[model samples]
Target: MDYERARAEQKLQLQELENIRLEAYKNSRLYKEKVTAVHDKNIKRREFQPGDLIFLYNSRMRLMPGKLRSRWDGLYRIERVEPYGVFHLSHPSSSELIKVNGIRLKLFHSEKMARNQELEIFLLEDPTTADD
Candidate 1:
């Protein structure tokens, strides 16, 4: 009977559609794996050591109204460096130690300046000294 033949053909088509759906799912997983590999390869490792001077990001600073205010609020010293980018920081004036991620810290660089001077800048309106 033609009806029997049509039913058999429909069953074969349904089986083929199921196989196609499984193959699509497999390809999606493969694509995600490749993307993850590429992302992991491009990440730069951060390293820190004890006694290093660094600034820490203050997450709460963004809540303030000052648009130009600095969000980084640390002159913290690295007291200890732990596994997986964790750092223990100590402020010179504070006895308490805080643990933070290395991603929240950046190395602090500075040059020694004269004691009575205002941080390496000359007042344009001020009278010049005899040494000038």
Candidate 2:
């Protein structure tokens, strides 16, 4: 009788352990689903239109003029739109224009252009010529 009781206890313990492991896996799957939902909600999609100026990311070939610099270069007009948000930009500096994706471009706003205009005025203004 003692041996039978010991065997029964061992079986119960194994079942308990399996239940605990299944619970842990269920919790982990739930956590992963929640995290993925939050991440998807927070992701933003970018779109561009014609005449919009964009700053191209420097990931092109080494021979490209903007490849050496990482920061924003002068404005380039959007000449054509391609699949998956890719665009073709035209600038006077280059004959072949560049093709870049939406992820590699940042939208330029008029507010930034106004700020640049103000900075240029400040640099070009002569302090002596101004009436104080």
Candidate 3:
């Protein structure tokens, strides 16, 4: 019967469409994993300890009109480091302490540089000519 043949064709078409959908889903999952891997690879890990100095990133400035101003604000000391990248910071000039996410802060490299007492500079000299 023509009706039976048409029904068989429709079932085949449905199966084909499902196969395409499944392939697309697999591809999407693969793409997401690749993207996540790339993103995780580029992430920089930051660690802080008690008494360590750090600078806090000011994310609020992006909405404001200050383009030339520096976005980092601090010289805060890490009073404590909590689990999951949370830090307690205290400003040098203030007694109040605040809890902030570690991602918003970066170690103050000045502490390391200041410890080095020696400064080195290299100067390049030109060869003198015999006809001088």
Best by TM-score: 3
List of clashing residue pairs for candidate 3: none
Greater-lDDT candidate between 1 and 3: 3
Better lDDT candidate (1, 2): 1
In order of appearance, the predictions have TM-scores of: 0.73, 0.64, 0.79
Clashes of each: 0, 0, 0
lDDT, each prediction: 0.86, 0.79, 0.88
- Model 2: lowest-lDDT 10 consecutive positions: 118-127
Model 1 scores a C-alpha lDDT of: 0.86
Task: Give Cα distance to truth, residue 100, candidate 2, Å.
Answer: 2.0
* Range of the 10 consecutive residues with the lowest summed lDDT in candidate 1: 110-119
Instruction: Report how far off residue 116 is in candidate 3 (Å).
Output: 7.1
Flag regions of model 3 displaced more than 4 Å.
Answer: 115-132
The per-prediction CA RMSD against the true structure, in angstroms, equals 7.6, 7.9, 9.4
Backbone clashes in model 2, listed as residue pairs: none
The residue ranges of model 2 lying beyond 4 angstroms of the native Cα positions read 59-70, 111-132
Q: Find the candidate with the highest lDDT and give its number.
A: 3
